[model samples]
Target: MLYTPAPLHIPDGFLSILVSVVCWAITIIVIGFAISKTNKALGEKQIPLMGVMAAFIFAAQMINFPVAGGTSGHLLGGALAAIVLGPWAGMLVMTAVIAVQALLFQDGGLLVMGANILNMGLVTAAIGYGLYRSVAGQSKTVKLTVVGIAAWLSVMAGALLTSLQLWLSGTSQLEIVIPAMLGVHALIGLGEALITVFALAFIIQTRPDLIGEGSESAKASRNWVFAGGIVSLLVVLLSPLASADPDGLERVAKDLGFLSVGQDAPYQVIPDYTVPFLGETALSTILAGVVGILVVGVIIVLIARGMKAKS
Candidate 1:
């Protein structure tokens, strides 16, 4: 069986080179600002916690839940990251995770990596975090409700952007792609919302310090070992149970007759999140997921440490 990344994530050849280049330029500019912001705002002690959070997000994203009508959607993690690590630092963490997913795990194309990061990282993180901030100072139930709504909105926002990019690339018509993408993503967004709320509630109970002061700054934690271990186990164990149904984006693409637009990457180290030696079995997928978690964790730690050093 051929392997493709969950969520499709704007595979290669679906976007024009011009669009890709523009997305890359914008991503670089925004991430530069994020790096500077994070450097000034993040504490030295929070570096390791950032790594664990990244790992947790990475693992959570691997658990794709089934939506209605034979479709699935996974956590995008932008809002969750922003909620836990502030918008700037969270964006940086998300960018690092997506970059590793594309470059090392082959979950997204290198060419379309910029677009993926733009859709899933910058836009979602900014909008979700902004909405979350707007609803602050409410009751816990209200805040969680608002977080749910923001999470849903964030997924829709990314879906809208994906549709627009696909339309611009001549993959699908705006009339057809927009509604299809939005419709499926609307449901997907619910899953994102629930997961975000649940995860946040768990953290609030177990480690409120990670949520920090005002979502713009965080308190440090030395207990990341337990959190990281739990996340690592989840990635290794539950990833094999991810739904086989096409994700929201892929379902829309197939239903809209644009699925053929995707092309294989020029090269892949671990194509479709499967280990080469393991040969497309459940074990291969689990091993790949574990490796991805570790890679993302380490990269986030290094990035956080660098930001701390610069500060």
Candidate 2:
């Protein structure tokens, strides 16, 4: 059988229209603020960094590693982004990644895109940056520890927010959904934490200036950008090896009997990360992932440049 990766974000029909609209309003307002903040503070070096971060996150998200209970999980990248790009630009990069996932890959629902961005992008970036900032001037070990905690908490926060949204949409009972969602996600969060910590550790060792406040002082270098693009492409090449198990939300929805309610995307474009003509082959997934990373990277770069120009 062809392996189909389960849905990674909230799909249409999973939440009520009212809830979606509310999420859209909140996301729009926050994103607008993010744009303003980024425009004012964005540095020349940070612009390309945002693009690289978005591309890396987009590619990394395609590789869902197993997390137990027949479930799988992937890096959210918000913590890493926030730590590297700061909160405002981090939000923009994450927003670009999620938006592209929904629009180009059909990985998430268009109508529920706002909720997905809010949960996975804004909330994660905020929490990650908030907690990480607490360790300013700390030792490297201390900083890594805090980053791991922040990343784990970010996943938990995303899970909690998702549960609330499901409850508010009347998709499941609050009592059952909360434990179910959080329980499974606790394991998933570990995976998130590990990936985040390891990625940060690598950055700190090879390019210490890329982390946190150091990013502002770092000079722009084409070599770093080239290296980042290579890493993202390497990740995409491994896309076919990603576990095919249902992700946290998908498993939760299935267990709670609401899986059937998830409506399909109204249209298809590289649906399921497979080029239609390629017919579910490994090459198809890799090709689609490459396209995703390139598209998200360029989009983020363009957005960052625009913000910089305005500033």
Local accuracy by lDDT, each model = 0.68, 0.68
178-263: candidate 1 lDDT, tens digit per residue: 66777778788898999899988888889877665444323322122223233333322322221222254354444333333332
In candidate 1, which residue ranges exceed 4 Å CA deviation? 1-4, 64-73, 215-311
TM-scores for every candidate against the unseen true structure: 0.65, 0.65
Error (Å) of candidate 2 at residue 233 is 37
Candidate 2, residue 59: how far the Cα is off, in Å: 1.1
Give model 2's clash tally. 0
Minimal lDDT window, size 10, model 1: 220-229
Backbone clash total, candidate 1 = 0
